[model samples]
Target: MIKKIFLAIIILISLTNSVNASTTSNYAEPVQTISKTYTEGFYKFDNKNDVDIGVTLITNTPTKIMILDENMNVQFISLIPYNTKFYLRNIAPKKIIAIIGDGEVALSFDKI
Candidate 1:
């Protein structure tokens, strides 16, 4: 009886670990993000190479955005009109920074 109970416990622990591993693997791994509010009427998101960044203007203000590389070279630029829910998709990750022109914004890193 004692041997059977010990064996059962071992099997249970193994099954638990397997289940946990599968559950963890079934989901996409989350990336670390630095979320901040740039209410200074300007914003910048440091884009990581190979990881696209998403920029959404949260306020009803006409704003222009620019994407730059690590060396301050411009990669892409756009303007978000007022009262519009702006979204940028599939933008290639840059080496340096992204800039917002005079607006409050919510930003995130998009999966590549």
Candidate 2:
């Protein structure tokens, strides 16, 4: 009876540990990239998932990037210079928009 009880407890503990390990593991979606060229205007993108995402912005000309919430409030903004690369990590926003003041610009967005 004693050996049976000890074996049962060990099995229960192992099962609990395995369950926790599986649940605590982190799983992220595959990276998605969007590239475009635009004149003196803005482009918007929808953020389907509310989870934190990483953004990589590459621009050929000076540009402005803004992340807004559902109410159109700016959550994040940055000015990237010509021929530069920018990165934003762990940001969860409702929308993303990029603006160009003058001339044409080439940019790309990497969602991770």
Candidate 3:
């Protein structure tokens, strides 16, 4: 019947539209790794208040940089490729150090 053929065509069109929807437009989420090898002393701030902390990892592949609090909560996570920079702000005075992960270098800057 013509009605059956029309319905089949509609279904095929719907399926084709769904299949053609783009997948590459979405941005990649940040990745992270957890490690305890980096010491808290590396994030040291001279002035303590309103300091900016930056971490960088130099490698041939993509690296994840993460900072965790004492309770194991993620404070910061960054998806940085080799020779990229990741940063966080609002340095809490009470916390002395944070755990660094994924073999990244830590650099700290205090308020001027």
Highest TM-score scorer = 1
Model 2: colliding residue pairs: none
For model 1, the superposed segments whose C-alpha errors exceed 4 Å read: 1-32, 39-49, 81-94
lDDT values, one for every candidate: 0.49, 0.46, 0.42
Q: Largest lDDT belongs to which candidate?
A: 1
For model 1, give the 10-residue run with minimal summed lDDT. Answer: 37-46
lDDT of 3 by residue, 1-112 (tens): 5575457445534643454364631111121222212331113223434555555554444444444343324465455555666566765543233332344454544443
Ranking by TM-score: 1, 2, 3
Tens digits of per-residue lDDT, candidate 2, 4-105, equal 545744553464345435644211112233455555432344445443433333445544555544334456656556664555554554454434345354
Cα TM-score per model? 0.48, 0.45, 0.40
| Least accurate 10 contiguous residues by lDDT in model 3 | 25-34
As a TM-score, model 2 comes out at: 0.45
Looking at model 2, residue 108 earns an lDDT score of: 54
